[model samples]
Target chain A: MKQKTITQSLSWLHTWSGLLFGWVLFAIFLTGTLAVFDKEIDNWLRPEIPAHSLDSREAAQTALDYLQARHPHARTWNIGLPNERAPTLSVSTGEQRRGGGQALDPETGELLQVRETAGGGFFFRFHFTLNLPRLLGIWVVGLAAMAMLAALVSGIVIHKKFFKEFFTFRPAKGQRSWLDAHNATGVLVLPFHLMITYTGLVIFYLIYMPAASDALFGGDREALNRALRGMPEQHAGQGRQPPQEVAGPAPLTALPPLLAEAERVLGPLASLSIHNPGRGDARIEVRPLLGNRIELTKGQSMVFDGVTGKVLRAPAESRPSLLTQRVLAGMHFAQFGGYPMRWLYFVCGLASCAMIATGLVLFTVKRRRRHDGEGALGAALYTGAERINVSVVAGLALACVGLLWANRLLPFELAQRGGWEVRVFFLIWLATLLHACLRPWLRAWQEQLGLTAALCLGLPLLNVVTVNRGDYIPLEVTILVIGGLLAACAWKIGQPAPERALRVRTEVN
Target chain B: MGLAIATGLWLAYSGMIALCLGLERHYKQVWGRPPSSSRRRALRATGWLALAASFAASVAAWGWAMGPIGGLGLVSLAGLALVLVLPYQPRLAIGTAVAGWPVLALATLAG
Candidate 1:
């Protein structure tokens, strides 16, 4: 009896927790899944930047020269070498700016004329930030992740037949089928779900659980960061002396030799940062591009004296705790994986989204069979829940595809074009919510899903008419095919039920 | 390489589904009668062996860490596939498991 009560309480906890944040969680999961291909999506969105190949050393040199001319006295010069994934030389000086910094064509070192669009970056940022104020958004997402972890735990506690029903599925049985699917997907990918949620929390641990760091570092966040990143401990009076005067500008050491040496030791170079360039105190740091290694940290880097090209500091050997934390972060961000692994993550993510959606539907389906028409309040609540279900599940999908259409249809030279694209996304999403409240639940589902299908299927045609870029033709066609299939499914769903058909037939007779 | 890995995944996944179906309770639920004891034993043994072989194949294709992760996803997909097929064509589901192993073996050897 005690065990039964515990299980019942856990079940209640799971259901309520899941329902409270299901919509936001769904959006986060879907967007995060898409973000796995962020670079590819970025390529598709900006068609102006033609693809080109350039040597890493040459690209670095080009970026440095451009930065020298543009911001000669800037405190820091950070040059990102072009690679296979992102084929543009990116340079940022001084403080980091909002969105992306200036990008240059590797071949000519000229500023790129790429169209302004958020592309997949919007989804990636929205997954955690939700377009809200940075601190608030992180806190809210952290809370949701915590709730998800609690729900997963409580759900496992409540489920008695874990293994016996591992592969169970009873389709067409309404609530039973939903429960089975929820269980199957949840249990099958439980490890992934847990890892993602926990690591998501860990990524923002200093913000979420700052007590330990605060106490340890005496409320110094920078110190805490240095400790976490395993930077060399600072000593008093290390650089307290006045800046040394030099005749005109110091002749800087050649970067190509340093680049070649770093590449030989650390694989392909991703980025190089020169601090206090053209000065005796100047330091150069080179970071390698991330590869398919299981390690969380990208390969080791080398810091060189900017003037003499002498080795200053090699990459710090990460402590075990830091390495573990990095691994967790890497798993969540999927920085150490290839295309195949990314595809696998995408599929698993979709399955998780399906699991959540089915669970939400099951809640209403189970209740409608019992207390649906019991009273005025019960009926009103049922209607509201049904509306929310249709809007959140199908409507969000419609809004996403609509955003893509806005990207294609919007005038290229329009001011704040990227901002307008985001606005169109929210506008469509809000419209769906309003429509869901006004229309019958069944009609809302059918209309929204049908619209989603039409928009998705029409995207490629719109592309042909407008941008006509051959780079993303195959991907666009795939989206069109998926949209068409979804449309067919929606049409099938919109058909009258067998019982309704029989009633209509009898009335006609 | 992609094809070979995908084939191995399918073999592992189908094998897992067959193992689940080998249980007498599940068999009874599906066919409305319990399978014979000897047939049940055979099914169970074959199911376990096939699953082991699939794991080996997966590991051979991908490394240990990724192989298990990929296997988990593939198994869930196979379970879903089984759910969709069993209600309409139970025999075909069984046949998939029976035929998957040999094809997987051939592909592994060729690769």
Candidate 2:
């Protein structure tokens, strides 16, 4: 065998690593992009919550009255205050309920009987976990992320004309076009690709790489956390102590005033947790809504004596190292810079998806031309890769949009409706894989993409007919744009191959 | 804030156009002729200046902490938009950046 150059080895590494993890990364990127607007999607899925603007103080008061009337003796009362993005007050007692407690109308304290659907949280959770069991999925995703990092570095090393071909893209030339697109998107958005991949790993740093924590703290993450936060071990331990007998039960201090004070210090408050709601020793912890800054203040909160309404401790200033990690994780979370920043992240995320998709396509397009010289196994592998690419890429798009259709069409009172929606999503995805396996290659690509376009384009009509809500305008408009793009793709895929085009031209001449 | 964001995005796009056109090949691709060394030098300098100004504008729009982060995003997208458009409609790509300035100025002055 000829001695392979370093570039050739790296090129092999990039192609194989990219192919192996590319599907997972594509799924991760697509859903992560959708999760950028998770809150909006959450709203669209749950149209029962009427849109309203109200004072945070006022909203907290309503939640307080509702909780006081119903769960006065509950150990802890957690209230999720309404904001512009999520305009529904919610209340839970003791432990936090999944799906963010029960939705309460912000205007009135009436409990809204919203349909039980997965909401946009499905995308957010699936983005990282791929609907696998939490730990396994996270580990799988982490492995994929590491592979992506390796691939990106290897890709940079192998590309010969990195700077020379900075703005080069020549379309409609088949393999050359695909390679140009792959290079263009990958190089142009290189910073975002690297940042997103690196930061995504960092978000689960301790979970993925427990070596440092394991060595220093004997794998006691809570202890490590307390040390990082500069917490007195005893004081931090007290915060986690289960509800115990405190001073004789007393009337809770007025919450609106406390909310106002907390908001002043912490910016807009997301939720308030009143520990021992009716007791003299009650402590109220108010957490600031994220997006006030680039650093994710995830667990940062102001603690107040619930009876006296006096500040017990201001949100602890993050020790410097923790702040650095939080800021990096914050970039991945994208909870800063308001809507414009979110939009930029969304667009960059889509570009990242394009880069990966183009790379996958380019692999198949390159291999297709050389299949004649291949052994049976090689040909089989090539065919397998081609089918897998179609199913994973186009099929995922179909499933994602199919999820919205499920959320709308499923009967509101159906038992396990959310689970059914998820099942529907998977079913659509599986069906596309079967379709890809059965249909001819070109036909399969055209049909699946065309169906995804139809679903995406018809989403507004589906929404109008089923839910009849205008609140999904932004989500619907975005889907329409994606639909238009996919429609164009389907049309392109339906066209005759280049060799056929050449033959027709010769015939005409 | 809206004007600031618009101006910042326009400046970033114009800056990317300048940097792209600073290269002899891209300069020839659009203008159909190679530029003199001095002209290329001027274009490169102007590109860097516009990018710096775009950073300042991003700061104005998103505040000090987020400006640098958001500014990078703006510049990246501006380059992406430029590259995609350059191959198909090179003059139109540069023209939009040129035309944006007066419209932005009018919007700024109206405020």
Best by lDDT: 2
Instruction: Candidate 1: list runs displaced more than 4 Å.
Output: A1-4, A68-75, A96-99, A234-257, A276-282, A298-301, A372-374, A499-509, B1-4, B25-33, B45-67, B88-111
Misplaced by over 4 Å in model 2 are A237-245, A500-509
lDDT for model 1: 0.76
- lDDT tens digits, residue span A428-503, model 2: 9999989988887777889999999999999899988997864777788899999999999999987888774563
Question: What shift in Å separates residue A386 of candidate 2 from its native position after superposition?
Answer: 0.9
Writing each residue's lDDT as its tens digit, candidate 1 over A1-509 gives: 45557888888888877887877787778778878777777776777666776889989999999988988898678888787676767899864343356778877888987777868788898889887898998998888888888988988888889888876777655567779888987887787788788988988877888899878998887787577667766521122334566434676789999999888877777888887787777778888876544456653567888888988776666788877777677778875446666767777787778877887877776776556348778767766777788888888888777877888788888999999989998899889999999876667878998999999888778878887864776567667776987798689767876754453344223
Candidates in order, interface RMSD in Å: 2.4, 1.0
Alpha-carbon TM-score of each model against the true structure: 0.88, 0.96
For candidate 2 chain A, the 10 contiguous residues with the lowest summed lDDT are A500-509
Point out the worst 10-residue segment of candidate 1 chain A by lDDT: A234-243
Error of 1 at A52 (Å): 2.8
What are the candidates' individual DockQ scores? 0.41, 0.75
Clashes of each: 0, 0
